[model samples]
Target: MAPTHSDHHHHNDGKKPPPKLLTLPTILTIGRVAAVPLLVATFYVDSWWGPNATTVIFLAAAITDWLDGYLARKMKQGTAFGAFLDPVADKLMVAATLVLLCTKPFEAGVFGQAPWLLTVPAITIIGREITMSAVREWAASQDGKLSEAIAVNNLGKWKTATQMTALTILLATRDGSLIGEGTLLASGVVLLYISAWLSAWSLVVYMRKIWKVLLM
Candidate 1:
């Protein structure tokens, strides 16, 4: 028997809506991920414009990071996919930039022949990111209280700000032309260490919050 018009309408109404995957926030998050390869390609350019280009790309991605979150809240376009993709994009860009910084002209130019200076903070920041990501995943699988306890805090914000600034300065000074090598590079290194410290501190705070749940 053929269904009546009213029955068809009711059937459509009862079905679950599809996930919103192409919203503006998700698009911006995807753009951030797309920028990663471009950022890396700049490292091989070996021209006066290379470092500047890398800086611009990194800065643009960083701006989009904030812009997407703001728009997501203001426009009510947030999605589960966006929430997941956003941090993955940020971590990819940061990890890639840090790895590149420890290579080539940057290794000697930015760190003054001491790769460990950059290496230590780079490893710390990356390790913290990895560990926290795992913790968040584990928390998500448990009771709701675990997730709440491990939510983002102000310290994470400060760490991101400091880390982004440090990377931008280091990228711009790769060839040492933007604002002289010594002072700017030193400033970047200092900020990076501070960022790493913040990362570790925040990780410890998160673990302390969830330790009881894990012990069970």
Candidate 2:
């Protein structure tokens, strides 16, 4: 019989295995976390790049969020640490960007003339993230699978999609870099509210699933 691919694996019998924390996927995940500081620095650069640079950097970092997971699964490089850190990286990106836009008071308001519009959506999204993280952490400390049950769902993914897109657009508007009409800021604000709605929906779903467990 011909030698099979698996049969060739015996050649590495003497080698030490690499550390779990050093995998390529995990490295990419770490890069995403590091990008947050870079993003913040770009905001204060005081140059032509301004929010334009942030938009590009933020978009790249956001893409890494999906790319890291895809590479992890495709390369079979997933680790326990990678699983834990990936979502933490994601939450950090979203929360930091939203807080930057909402509190910085860009031109009187971050996205709109109405003070509460941007504030409400930012708070909604941020609050839901913090709450869900606490809930999932507590659930994991109890029953391991309990957290997985309420883990990232379709709605949660949609919330991230909308949230990332909205923030990207909102930031772009700050430097007068709108892709279309002058109403891009307003559009971003509207999408932010939509994302927040989805954020709230996902939180409610997670809480309902674990409410009984939490009561005990």
Candidate 3:
């Protein structure tokens, strides 16, 4: 039997109440955003113990990025506010990781290459985000339709998963004393490049769709 829109909403309503801006997922997302500072602290603290502590905290924060989304969906508590906070949380997390991962006492040991190379992935991700955001805003302005920023893409998911995994592994080697440091760093480098490539391709795919709408 085909489900009517009313039937869908009816079922959904019984499962959960409407999400408020101050709901669990929104709070979790904000927590993730706030973790960026602690991530940065690890790089600049100039103490062996501090970096390790910071790394652990950063990993916990990154894990929450996934947790909040899963909880929001499972609980049928995805609010408009959650939608806004999630991406902002993600961007800040990635940006913080890149900055910290490329800094002294960690970059060479964990990156397997010059710290500067990390910038390639950073720029790629940031560029796509900025471009796609502008395209969506432009479309909304022209059409008077309030499409809350562009929806997430599959490639974006892949990029995030790979990036977080790479960062996690890289951070786990914080003391520059972990076994397979070279192998881990090499893997991280590969993941970073792959992520960058995907980011660029995803941008093209998103832009193409937006262009069609604009041309029409």
Using all chains and alpha carbons, the TM-scores for the candidates as numbered come to 0.88, 0.84, 0.79
TM match of model 1 to true structure? 0.88
Best by the lDDT measure: 1
Q: What TM-score quantifies how close candidate 3 is to the native fold?
A: 0.79
Candidates 1 and 2 compared: the better one by lDDT is: 1
Q: How do the residues 100-126 of candidate 1 rate in per-residue lDDT, one tens digit apiece? A: 987753544544667478889999999
lDDT of 1 at 34: 92
Give me the overall lDDT of model 1: 0.89
lDDT (10s digit) by residue, model 2, range 102-152: 666555333345656678888898898888878777887877657766767
- Candidate 2 backbone clash number: 0
Poorest 10 consecutive residues of model 1 by lDDT?
A: 104-113
Q: How much is the lDDT of residue 40 in candidate 1?
A: 89
Candidate 3 ranges with C-alpha deviation above 4 Å: 1-19, 105-115, 144-151
Q: Comparing candidate 1 with candidate 2, which one achieves the higher TM-score?
A: 1
Ranking by lDDT: 1, 2, 3
Poorly placed runs, candidate 1 (over 4 Å): 1-7, 10-19, 105-112, 212-216
